[model samples]
Target chain A: MFESADLTILAGLLSRYLVVLQAQQALLNSCTHFYQLEPRLARWLLMTADRAYSADLYLPLILSVQQRTYNTADLYILRSLQVAGCSVHWQAANDKRKFF
Target chain B: MIKENFFEQNHLLREFPQDVQQRLFPLLELISLPLGKVLYESGDPSNFVYFPTDAIVSLLYVMESGASAQISMVGNDGVVGVSLFMGGESTTSRAVVQCAGSAYRLNGQRLKDEFNRHGMLLFLMLRYTQSLITQMAQTAVCNRHHSIDQQLCRWLLLSNDRMPGNDLHITQELIANMLGVRREGVTDAAGRLQRDGVIEYSRGKISILNRPQLEVLCCECYAVVRTETERLLPWVFQKGCTVKTTEASMSAAKAD
Candidate 1:
């Protein structure tokens, strides 16, 4: 288990791709309400990312799982990176960890 | 055709043939996206492709009782509605705005029309689709494993990247909903962070106090995700964006 501070910087670096660009207009314009849920999403992704070992291979595995489950490509690649990390640990370990 | 703006945001854009860029660019539109908005719902048909210029959107899976958890988030570095290019018209997840910003929204048909032209867009979207799937699978794994503190640390890190600061304006209750856990769980996690001097939370606001310490408490998931993102999406991170592994914490974790 790592300290929270180190994890924050690491997670932030991983998620830099999630920052929005300026000047682009939203078709639905629903960020404010969605923003309300960011903390939860962020925390979930963060927790998952912290558990996984490698992002490169892990990301591909995540994509594979979603491809099997969702059958659509409308997913967040960056966020999935975090999820892959978590899944690796969760599946690899038999113990039930109290996360997410 | 992928435009300069699109190319600038995505490194993969440069790998495309000029003709492909030209083919895809005309279809791209400059649009604005607001915060906390719903772009698509579970089972709703997708109608457009979104390339965020300055916004972040969350892909959420809402439970039957209205409880929801965010599966992922998209921003400038990516495009929304990859299913159009990936051969799907809809998905089970809902897209909502995680941050209040802007993005270019392209009509789903226009995007597909251009994609049918098929060259760079086809390949790029496919790779992107692969990346997105990775996140969803990882999410399921993380939710099932890891400690709450570790999870909180990972969450903070992801959010920190989307903004310019350590402070985030979000409520614990809202976070609980997103995590698909009870509000008390978030409160407890926040409380622990506060006690440890890792964060300062007041009302709905959270200020990261010690990033290194927070990372120390988290599992390897955060680093794995970040490293993968950097690898798959080159040009997104600057040179030598190393994952800092402090000596003190390594010893501490081992000792514990």
Candidate 2:
């Protein structure tokens, strides 16, 4: 349903995004000992927001998908973000509420 | 000295200039790499660099808590022990044989000497290193963003590309270790894949039943690594194409 030109442009943009994402990941991996969790979390949140095109994001789903458990530091980081004008909500797994 | 034909089995060695091949062939020691063989442990000084002809090696970064994840994989299309030529005698990653096969090993010093010549070997090694970096970076991103099922598909596709057959002689436990996930997670994912008719797993062996479906199910990480690798090392794939064409023409002539 799409024209060739449109597909080409989309492919180009996707490739550019991948390249930048790769560079960012490589940097984070190489400097794991140098950077603290706060900056890393902030960067991740900002990138997620940009990609999702919304400030309202779901962290629990991401945590479950990555098979990661939140520690005190992670909870503290979320609280700090909430204090910085970002609304934070905790929803149970069975909750049917949709906040878009 | 091993037979000269053995060199052709490895794409990187196959593309060596005739003179370079003649010089290097005498130095290569062919050895069988068994599954779970530790080529080099993390932080250990590497003594030899291996050019795998039919083996798959996983470069894993081990954490302090004893967990590890594969950063990249090296097979016939490339060489192991980049740190040897990259001027680092040791790396934080451990290289282990993921599949049982043979590889031609060269003394680390000998490879370093050859690399310093700034010839075809140097050029190829640099390009291969770039591709390896791309793979490692893509793996980091995949680990962060992709689901376990998608990651398993990506892993299978990448491993399938480096070997000869549709069957992979690896266990779910080893795959779990490589992905840094629980064994149960891999079991569930592999089960789903089998149910979908994409693969068949039986007693540590996995046979890919439908490659097209597997690719469709894989994440973009696999394609990103494959594209970058082919772009950085075009000669590796080109050599394969040339051989296929030569065989086809020879068969046609024989038929006449």
Off by over 4 Å in 1: A1-100, B1-20, B23-27, B162-167, B239-256
Clashing residue pair totals per candidate (backbone < 3 A): 76, 0
- For model 2, residues B1-256, the per-residue Cα lDDT tens digits are 5656657777888877777788878888777788999999977998999988777999887766677788788877888887766566776788999977778888888877776665777677767777888888788778766889999999999888776667889999999888878999999999999999999999989999999999999999999998998899886656652222133433443343
* DockQ, Cα level, model 2: 0.06
What RMSD, rounded to one decimal, does every model reach?
18.2, 12.7
Off by over 4 Å in 2: A1-100, B239-256
- Measured with C-alpha atoms, the lDDT of residue A7 in candidate 2 is 55
TM-score of each: 0.59, 0.71
Q: How many backbone clashes does candidate 2 have?
A: 0
Q: In model 2, what lDDT does residue B41 have?
A: 91
lDDT for B20 in candidate 1 is 70
